[model samples]
Target: MIFVSLYLFMFCKMEENSGHISVADFSKHLFWDVNKSEIDLMRDRHYVVRRVFSCGLMNDWNLICRLYGIQEIGEIAKQIRDLDPKSHAFIALIAKIPEEDFLCYTTKQSTPQHWNF
Candidate 1:
């Protein structure tokens, strides 16, 4: 019982520090349609962080609450709101990506059938 409790506590602490989504995980979910090269470029250029921040800020509160939990939403909002001007500007730059782009990235599509000659 003691070991279980300790493990649970550690797990919660780890989750708390990592935020609800890490850059890598957020990238996977956001850019599911993009090839690995694009994903790699986004990661290398810190585009993942920008996208996560933009999604967090622009997405509805209900969605945010669903993803991060009701309790976590407040903390996440506060952290983003508290970001310095320079950091906020950087996030805003990438946040300009169109809603259509997000939709295209997340939408499910059937695989194309190969043609035989």
Candidate 2:
């Protein structure tokens, strides 16, 4: 009975953590504001903003399309499909951008080891 209870507890803990988006994780990884338009980000030359358009994440692509009033989501999706059909569409697009760009946008105060990646 004790072993069975412990096994169930561990299973539940794993399920809770899987695909869970914690606030700290979201803030640390995604530096861009969802409310900001693509034009505003372009004018500011934000790294994440630029990459989100060119990158493969469907969620980011859709959000940018909606925020910017652009109708290029399908086109972008086609491009991503052509490039890597096996890639995960919903995962965060942080790894798509170059490390240099991340370092440039990330402050030391916010991300102490930003350059390590």
Residue-pair clashes per candidate? 0, 0
Once fitted onto the true fold, the runs of candidate 1 whose alpha carbons sit more than 4 angstroms away are 1-24, 27-29, 36-38, 41-45, 56-117
lDDT of 1 by residue, 1-117 (tens): 456434533444455433343234443455555654455522333343334444533233223323443234323323342233333333233233323223223442354325412
Question: What ranges in model 2 sit over 4 Å off?
Answer: 1-48, 54-56, 71-117
**TM-scores of all predicted structures:** 0.24, 0.24
- Specify the highest-lDDT model's number: 1
Clashing pairs in 2: none
lDDT value, residue 104 of candidate 2:
26
Model 1 clash count equals 0
Write down the TM-score for model 1. 0.24
C-alpha displacement of 57 in model 2, angstroms?
Answer: 1.5
